[model samples]
Target: REHEPLITVEVAVQLTDAKKFFKVPRTFRVMVCPGATVATFREVVGQDLAPSGRVMVPRGKEAMMALQDSEELPDKVTVTEFKGKRQVYVKFTMAQCYKVLSLLRGHLEKAESQKALHEAAIEVAEDEMEYRLRLSQFLMTEAYPVVCRHFGLGCDGVESLRVIPAGMYLVDQHLELLELQLEVETLMKNRGTVNFLMGKINELRHKFGLPPADYPPHLLNFVYSQSLLS
Candidate 1:
């Protein structure tokens, strides 16, 4: 109202009690009544030039409300903005301040819940990626040699392999050995091997506070023996 004394109110980033909220050089500034309650103050902060008044915000009607809700807002504080161009002021009765604080408390709890959920989701994704890498490494170091021995293929220093020997130089013997090697490679790459390794890796990963690894589909098609040859 025109009869009301307009006390300049400037909302600051430092006003947040904990966990610094706003990062940039920005704030909410408006002239509000010294007699206004927190509820009225909220309305003033959200009001734009709907009536085409001097209170023109940078964005629109909802700008201050959006900024206020995003962080822990200060209460009944007096400060200065732009040294003197904007004067920071707030005057709330104890009862009104308490009510606003209660509402903000509930909002903080909800914000914290949202933050925790987001962080948990990211942690799950990163842990799964690490699990896959570790599982692949285990297969190469532990399972590959076992597969090679079963197929009678000689692994050279855990590196390359000697081709299946054609004993007696018989073509049939050479083809049979080749077929056996291919079968061994297929089994090593089967989904069963992935499932087996997941079980082993989960035990170690979980011990280190990481989430358990799920049986991955991509791992089922990753041919370790063929990759080694390549």
Candidate 2:
């Protein structure tokens, strides 16, 4: 068995194979399961190490008949220990290579199916800020003019309104009115006129010993208005 030369066999494969070639030849490597020597392995039927260049693999589907085949199927194995004392190696025939690859193919398909199902089941929610930003984008991009169209103003200056006091302006004349209205509103609020009034009352009551009901802001007449009226 040791002196026997490995017989080279010619392999003939047809090329009508189109998409099948796209599926690259996948290798399913595994360490030879130790403690199962070729002798003990040969005991099983239909399992003869093939006469490939090296390495013997099963040629049997049956436990009894395969061992008989191995007696004639000289050993083609060349054992190599990987790295240090990690593992012993034994090669297999092309037929055995197919067996391992078949198992891998099945497992890979199942894994892909599971991954797809997991992805489908997931329901990622939109964040609050993301939704608000989308609403802002739609308003800035589309809503303003559409609303103006509803009013029949023939307005088309939505993008310009990125600043405040933005809507429904015919020209620069409206800007001063809008500014005054904003100032009036602000002065009327708690942070404006109300606050100023309260502060003044406090100053009068504490510094002058005058009550709030008796004190109001002292009026200062501007020269322009007074002179004009005169």
Candidate 3:
């Protein structure tokens, strides 16, 4: 048995109705890795208890519900002891099972999207610092919310913006204007591009309910000069 594959275990899930009554007291067997998480078994069992499809059950009245009720599935599922056997056990109404399947599907899609975006962001970043910052921002702003939503956790979904001040985005704009002013440069007459970038910064701030960024003194002078020149 030394080189044998890891033995798979049978997880028993008992089917019940929303009322916690043993509508179908029989245990259904699902094969999975011994160390698999409860979520894994839930998915396996959910598929076996597929809604809107026929499963081979002896009793003719054992019709699976087309979907699960939202209130039926618990936030966390764990293996509990039953009749002195060390086996995983769960109970779900047909409606609850369907709901679980739908939720799992949506969660998988969101997780995949997060992973794709993270990889793409890393590739697109110009330097290591940019990649790290962008990755962290994506995780906090996008991935964290997706996870929180799936787990029914309270999330404001503004974690990244909360950590990064509104003025940070405008810092480069302020510096550029200051440099132009100190050099007495007048080659860049139109402030349209600067205004557009500022507009975007303000739009982001408004969307997230963040305070408006204040202009640095030198930058303010440049804006004043532009307005007079225009």
Candidate 4:
């Protein structure tokens, strides 16, 4: 209720999603209460403004009031472009109309979801394969040396990375990285933690024992040469 909302403003609405492509209303009106503030107008219908393809379910004070008892009235409706073309019964209240609007928030837009989902799916696959290879190599070449140096449990014939408890050891190594990436992605999605993103980079560098990213070029080159030659 906005504008001339005395007791309550009667309204009609349609909101739903199970249709082809994005939906939009065939036609709609711009009527608003004469003295309704911009805030009031927003309160009433600001959210229904999605373009073609997104659900444009009908919404209006008159429509909601008019179709209060129509048998053909939809419990929910999807919109198509050109609200004039989309046939929807009037909604009953801004609240009822907006309830269906809630469904729109998580609706995956095709391009974004596909790209993100594909990236995630492929990333997990590639990371898993790489982790398996590196971990297998680590057990044979590195862990035994480390274990021998530290615990002395590494004895004869312990040639490879000890296969500890099947997949458990491998999971421990890569899962931490995966968890960090997931946390970063979640924060980014909600437009949060620019500071944390920077902090994370610093933390990861230290955690991985990495040299400063901006280390002098000659020093880096010498280090690289030493690594290769030595």
Candidate 5:
């Protein structure tokens, strides 16, 4: 059978463990006589690729068939038999295997840690929303009514007093109401002072036998208005 014609066959070195990380396989080609024993073919392939590994062939669609030492290479062996196939799976030495395992473990741990942090952030956001909701409810239902009663304002006044949209936080509205109260108090004080001064001026005009000074209608009305008092 030494006179048999040589056949070319494709051979790929399987990166099994490394492929899980790198995802690339290695392939090459070799010429062999059909009469050669599987062991001899494996030796020839191993010498060029991995010195220590088993040679295999495609069994079916998804299975690899390991070639036995005593078996002979099929007479019709062709490149298509091993093309894009995992022809030989090379096993890493013990040390290399351990290093790959360690890397895999670290990657898994990091993924778990990231997932845990994401879940924690979601929980914190939920809690904050709940607190804001509770605070807003208290301001609207309890605090707002009390503020309205204190200022002698009716429901319409409370509605009109909102300077911000209803969707916004009620705390800002409460602050705006307090500012309005302060402004009202200041206006009342200023009006009283103006009235007193005006009365004194009129009295002086009367003693001098002159007519009272005519102030602007808007100013007089503003100083004497009683809307806020009611």
Candidate 6:
């Protein structure tokens, strides 16, 4: 009869007294037969470590939790129980795991910082767009009609009287609106950059072995949902 193939699994070992021992947590890959007992797996992991007391594996979902709150794997449990899992967490004691966590935390921090900057830029862009829209509306709806009445041209002559001094103000306002529109277009194009940064933040979070972030409604929704000009 053919024998079952060996399964390769990653074992992440948490050092008990990392600070005192001046050592960091470590991970090792080991090959074990499908039906191998948990006891056998622990022995194999111990061979690569120092004389750090007992080697214990966390049970099921507890592997992702703090070591102190996690239950140890039973000696009679078969390695095949974890066949689908790529990595397992083990430790010498219930103490905290450092080193690897610290490195991942550093990466997460940087990603969060970059995301913040992108969010700030989006807010500024939205504010500037709103300001320009308000000014343009005021000039067209309120100021333009009042100027036409003062020049005794009424609404009909307003467009034909562009050469007059009063009409020049309307012309200048139109040019300003065009410039503002261009600036808004440039800012809207930056939405792609903001999306790229958000992707990086989520990627880093996953690498840190964290759950999805709970963003506020405004952030969770699309940054530019409505037309800026509208």
Best-fitting candidate, measured by lDDT? 5
lDDT of 1 at 40: 51
C-alpha RMSD (angstroms) for model 6:
28.5
Q: Estimated TM-score per prediction?
A: 0.18, 0.17, 0.19, 0.16, 0.28, 0.22
> Candidate 6 versus the native: TM-score?
0.22
lDDT pick, better of 4 and 5:
5
Candidate 4: where are CA atoms >4 Å away? 1-127, 154-160, 163-230
lDDT of 1 by residue, 166-220 (tens): 1112222233322333333233333344444445455656565777654344444
Q: Candidate 4's error at 208, in angstroms? A: 33
Candidate 2 Cα outliers beyond 4 Å, as residue runs: 1-83, 111-230
Candidate 3 residue-wise lDDT, 1-230, digit = tens? 01111223333334334774746444423333334444444454444433433222122455422212332232223222222222222332233323333433354346564465446544754343554455445546544455335323333345323322221222333433333222221112224444555555566666668787675665555455524232
User: Rank order by lDDT, top first?
Assistant: 5, 3, 6, 1, 4, 2
Task: Point to the candidate with the largest TM-score.
Answer: 5
Evaluate residue 148 in candidate 1 and report its C-alpha lDDT on the 0 to 100 scale. Answer: 36
**What tens-digit string does per-residue lDDT give for candidate 2 at 1-230?**
11111131111122224675666332212222233343433222112223321233335562222223223332333211112111112233233333322332343245553343233223213233443344344334444344333323233444313321222122122323323333332221112333354444455455656554332322212111221111
Tens digits of lDDT, candidate 5, 86-204: 23222222232233223323432455533543343354453534433443443355344543343222332234224111212221223332233223322322344456556655665
lDDT of each: 0.36, 0.30, 0.38, 0.32, 0.42, 0.37
Which pairs clash inside model 3?
A: 67-95, 68-95, 68-96
What overall lDDT, based on C-alpha atoms, would model 1 receive against the true structure?
0.36
Which ranges in model 1 have alpha carbons more than 4 Å from their true place? 13-22, 47-230
Instruction: Identify the runs in model 3 with alpha carbons over 4 angstroms from their true place.
Output: 1-126, 158-230
Tell me the lDDT of candidate 2: 0.30
Each model's number of backbone clashes?
A: 0, 14, 3, 31, 0, 0
Candidate with better lDDT, 5 vs 6: 5
How many times do residue backbones clash in model 3? 3
lDDT of candidate 1 at residue 207, scale 0 to 100: 65
